[model samples]
Each structure stands twice: as structure tokens, then as C-alpha cells.
Target: KEIVGVTRDITEQTKLQKALEEERDRALLYLQAAGVMLVALDQRGKITLINSKGCEMLGYSEEELIGQDWFNLCIPEEERDKVKMVFEKLMDGEELPYEYFENSILTKDGKRKIVAFHNVLLRNQEGTVTGVLSSGEDITERRTAEEALKRLNEELELRIAQRTEELEAFTYSVSHDLRAPLRAINGFAQALFEDCGEQLDEKGKGYLKRIQEGGTRMSQIIDALLNLSRISRGNLTLSEVNLAEIARSIMKEIMEQEPSRKVNFLCPPRLMAWADARLIQIALTNLLHNAWKFTSLKEEAVIEVGERKEGREKVFFVRDNGAGFDMRYVNKLFSPFQRLHKAVEFPGIGIGLATVQRIIAHHGGWIRAESTLNEGATFYFTLTKGG
Candidate 1:
């Protein structure tokens, strides 16, 4: 007990323990921090230190970055001279803490990283700029995500093309196989009504005639389905086209689709556009046919085709004074296989407007419809100026 009572100096040991504790805390922070990359450059702008986070941000190991000239290692060669100039400015007691957004940095992995930097100058006691301390942030992932999204959209378009081709093949098979049997039945029924009319009563003759008519109607639908498929699968050959000529041609086509109906087509002459003439003609034909079909109850049908300017864009409209539909169902108007009227009344497969929408999209444009029940309807589309 007497020996243990001897006095001892413990100051050095206590200080050493505190220093060790601080070092351990720093190591823990280095392990946990994912902050903006931290790097320090000496007065000559040589990298004196790059923390763990910095190495990870630039896809480099610590050993590769340390002792390397930070500017030469990361910046583009052309920009290195400017960086040296900036470093000289910093050493001359000038400082810059901010720069523009969306600058690029060459990463160790050979891929470019978009980065933004903020820096502070370290000073000595005599107020000399000794070095630079920088905090850099990486925006590569965001840029990569944007590029990937763009490619995904392109892939989606290609996939749609492939699917449409497959549907066309299926449609061909259905059109051929389905119409053949229907044609045979219709032919045999007509033959019975003509060549064997004396063997059947008036009711039997009426039954045969109804069978032929129903078969003929079904065959007409099959043919319409094929035409609708053609509209969707056709390739767009974009060029400068006159909308007035397209409208005139569409009026003629619609008249052919329904020869008995009287349709008044009004369109301006020499209206110009940048789109595929064939695709636009198809879209116009569909719209005009719809106008004529819906206006069968009216004695006079009025259809107008024209363009209007709207805020750095041009909108073209196909307006009709005919039977319209409810606004509540407008959302489904351009959807494939959706119809506002019954098959018996409208006599279509409901793919016409969908085809028109696809054509507009191919031209980097958009279309919308506005209508009210028992009133007139208008279909509007916009073709971008530079697409």
C-alpha cells in the first residue's frame, strides 16, 4: 500500500487516450458518410487527400486517386489548362465557390459523370492560399436514367410495330377463313331464292333473303376490319404536304364509302403542313366517313377541314354538323375497339380513330375531340413545327 501511494504523472497518458478517441470517431464518420465527395489539393493543386466517399463517387480506389494531380486525373485535357488558370487565381488570393450546373467529369471507369462543385480555399497564417478543398456531387445516375428512359420509349415503339404486324397476319387469316364460309352460305341462299323459288312459299323466300343479307353484312364487317388494320400498320412517309389536297381526296374517298349520302365538304386551298400525306389522308378519310355516317338522319351534312394557330403550334380541325356523342365518354373515343354507337347503327369496327391517333403520334403530334350528345363534333390535331 505504501509503494502504491507514490506520486505519478498521468497527463501525457490522458492526452494520448483523447487523441486515440478522436481518431476512432473520425474513422467511424468515414465509414458512415455518403456526403458530397471530399478532396484536398496542395498549393500546386496536387491531390493530397481523397476521402473514401470521394473515391467511391468517381469510381476510383483511394490508392489510385491519392498523390495524383486531381485536375489532370479527372478533368478533360482541354479543360485542364483552364483549371490551372483557376488554381493560379485561387493562389493569388481569389476564390470561386460556385459554378454552373451540368458540367462533366471523366470518371476512373472511363464513363463521363455530370458533376457540380463547390470549393473553399485553405489559408496559412500569413493569409496565403495554401491549397483548395472541394466538395463534388455526382449526377451520373440521373442522366443515365434519363437516357435509359428515352431508349425504353423507342423500344416500346418498335414493339408496337412488331405486335401490329402479328395482328395483321391474324387479321388476314380471319378475313379469309371467315368470309369464305359466309360467301358460300350467301351464294347458296341466293341460288335457292332464284332457281328454286317455286318449291318454296313466300315465308321461305323471305327467310332465304334475310340469310343472304345477314351474311353480306357480316362479310362487309370483315372487309372493314382489314381496312382498319391497314390504316394502323401503314408506314408514315413524312414530308411537306398540303392539307387542302388531303382534305379534298378524303372527301372523294368518303363519298365512295357511302355513295348515296350527300356530304358538303368545305376546306381551304393550299393549306400546308409537315406530315405524311398518306397517313394524314387516311386519318381525314376516317373522320369524314364518321361525319357522313352519323349524319344519315339529317338531310344536309356539313363537314369543314381547316387549321388554326395555337401558341407556337398549328391545330387542324375536322368539324361536322352531325350526330355527336357524350363528353363523358370522350376519354375512350380514341381507344382501340371502343365505339359510341352500336354495330348495327354505326357499321364499323371502331379502330378508325385509334389508327388516326397513332398516325398523329408518329408525326410527333396529338389529337383531341370535343363533342356533345345530339350536337356536332370536332376532331382537332396538332403537328409540331420541328419534330
Candidate 2:
């Protein structure tokens, strides 16, 4: 009888010990969770338990906080008012629940830290508020990041404004000051040739002609550049546009200008678009004209205008069998005065593509180009559905 009673007692003790171990393990696991910093402070604001995150946040070890007064860390002599309201609420029997407060706390190394405190009332089994449990989250990194980003944005805005002013000044100088001298050079050269052509040799006459051509080309380039600049700051007058009609008009104009070149323009019968009508016309004309000029060497020049639904995006491509540039030059293709072909071969200021890109971007669309040397080039872009 005695042996049996002892075994029974041993079994009960074993079960009780197992339950205690399980409870301890669970408490440890709860404290290990990263975001939640479990803490326990007594009625006197004395520190009882500080979890891993709590210690890490206050930049201290649990050894330092335990048994120390927690409120002393928060309410400095000057800022004791921080908790005066908290105490008032507690005295009112209104269990002051989780409240957010930001303050500095002294660390194990005797350094102060600014942390966000989320304090909640901890009650006993009798349903009486016994102590406060606070969660501390260190937001130093986040604050630093936001401050840096704000500074960067401010700097970028200032730089952009300065750059815009510089561009306007340059444009004003180029339009008025630079053109006047070029006009004089060309005009004086023409007069010189008209009066002195009879006394000049073939080479001399050719030199004068070259001077006139250079001045004329330079003027055309200036106009193209100015047009590109206007695209950025100009208000777009949007309207519905029939891309097929625009393509046909551009094709006819090109054909009339260069009738000897055999060019085929395949515009889908029903392709319509929503854009600035005049701007769209200009963009399409430039693209079509570009394709025509690039393919001047090919006996069979072909250009296709078509649209397709790509994933959630609507894409339109202008494909041509032309003297395409190397793909490596793609980045430069949309920059002002950036060209792959010599100005003699392609009579452009290289601002056409830049202007086209600007218009497409203003419509909240993107443009891409694919090409290979001597093969062909295809330019793809998107258009907004309606104005």
C-alpha cells in the first residue's frame, strides 16, 4: 500500500513539472516575437520584466532595467508632466489603456535614446489594474530615412528650377543673338557671290555655296531644337485623332517631295487615337518621314502602322525596313542633338525623336526602339484612351 501511494505521488509530480516547463517555454516563445516588446512595470513604475526587444530598443541589457524604476527613465525632472495625465487617468479608475508617447530613456551605457512607447495597463486575476506593460519600437532608422529623402527631394526641386531657368536663358540667347550673326554671314556671302562671281574660279564659287548651305542648315537645326524645348513646358491641346489619315497625309507629302523613291505606307484602315491632334500629326509625320529617308537605299521600302494588345497595355508600332542604327545607341536616340547618322545623310537636327518621346511621355506612355545595322527599325509606343 505504501509503495503504490508513493508511485501515485511521483506520477502527479511528474505531470505537474511537465506543465510548468511547457508554460515557461511558451512565455519565452511569446517574448521572442520580433515586433512585440513585452514589458512589465509595477504600480510604483518599477521595472519587473523586460523582453529582448525592450532591452534592444532602450539600448540596454535586461540586467540593467530589472529592479530599476521605469518611470524615472521616462519622466525627467523637467518633463514629469509627461505622466501627470497618465496618473490622473489611473486615479479616475479609468484603466489608462495603450497610449503612445515618445521620450528618451537612459541606457546601460548611460546614453539617452528616443523611442516610441506604447503603454498598456496590466491587470491581475482579480480584475484590478496592477501594473503597466509597455512596448517600445525604435524608429530611429525610419526617421533618418524619411529625413534624407525629404532633403534629396528639396535639392532635386531646386536643381530642376535652376536648370529650367538656364535653358530659357540659352534659348533666348540662341534665338536672338546667334541667328543674327549666321544671317549676316549667309547674306554677305550671297552678295559677294552675286557681285564677284564673274571674277571667281569654280572652287571659289563652290566655297561660297558651301557657306550658304551651312548657314541654312544651322538655322533649320535651331528651329528644330526650339520646337523640342516647347514640347516640355507647352500645354497640349488634346483631341481625337485618326492615325491612318495622319499617316496618309505625311506619306503624300513625302512622296511629293521625293517622288523617285518607291515607298509603301501600310496604315490600318481603322486605327484611331486620343492625343493632341496637331502633336500626333507631327509625331507620325516625323516617324514616317524618318522611315522613308532611312530606307532611301532600298528599292523596296516598306512602312507598317499597326496596333496590338500587349498584356494589360495597348501598344502601337511603326515598323520600317530602313538603314537602322545600332541598338547600343538607343539611349542617345531620345536626347536632343543626338544622332547616329551624319547630318549630311539625314537632314535633321536630331530633335525629332526627342520631341516624339516628350509627346508620348506627356500622354503617360513609354517609347522603345529596336533595330539592327542595315536591317530595319521598329518604334513602339502607347497612347491614352481618351483626353
lDDT of 1: 0.80
lDDT of 2 by residue, 1-387 (tens): 355443345888899999999999997888767575677777776889888888776666888789987767644555556665674465344654637766655665666556677777777798777877777776667777889999999999899879976895688567767778888998899899999988889999899899988899888877776676666566777777788888888888889988887887788877777788778887887888789889888999999888888898778889999899999889999987888999688777787888889889877788999999899899999987353
Q: Weakest 10 consecutive residues, lDDT, candidate 1?
A: 96-105
RMSD of 1: 9.8
Model 2 segments more than 4 A misplaced: 1-20, 23-140, 270-273, 309-311, 383-387
Candidate 1: list runs displaced more than 4 Å.
1-70, 76-136, 144-157, 232-239, 249-266, 296-302, 335-337, 343-351, 361-364, 383-387
- Which residue pairs clash in candidate 1? none
TM-score of each: 0.64, 0.67
What TM-score does prediction 2 earn? 0.67
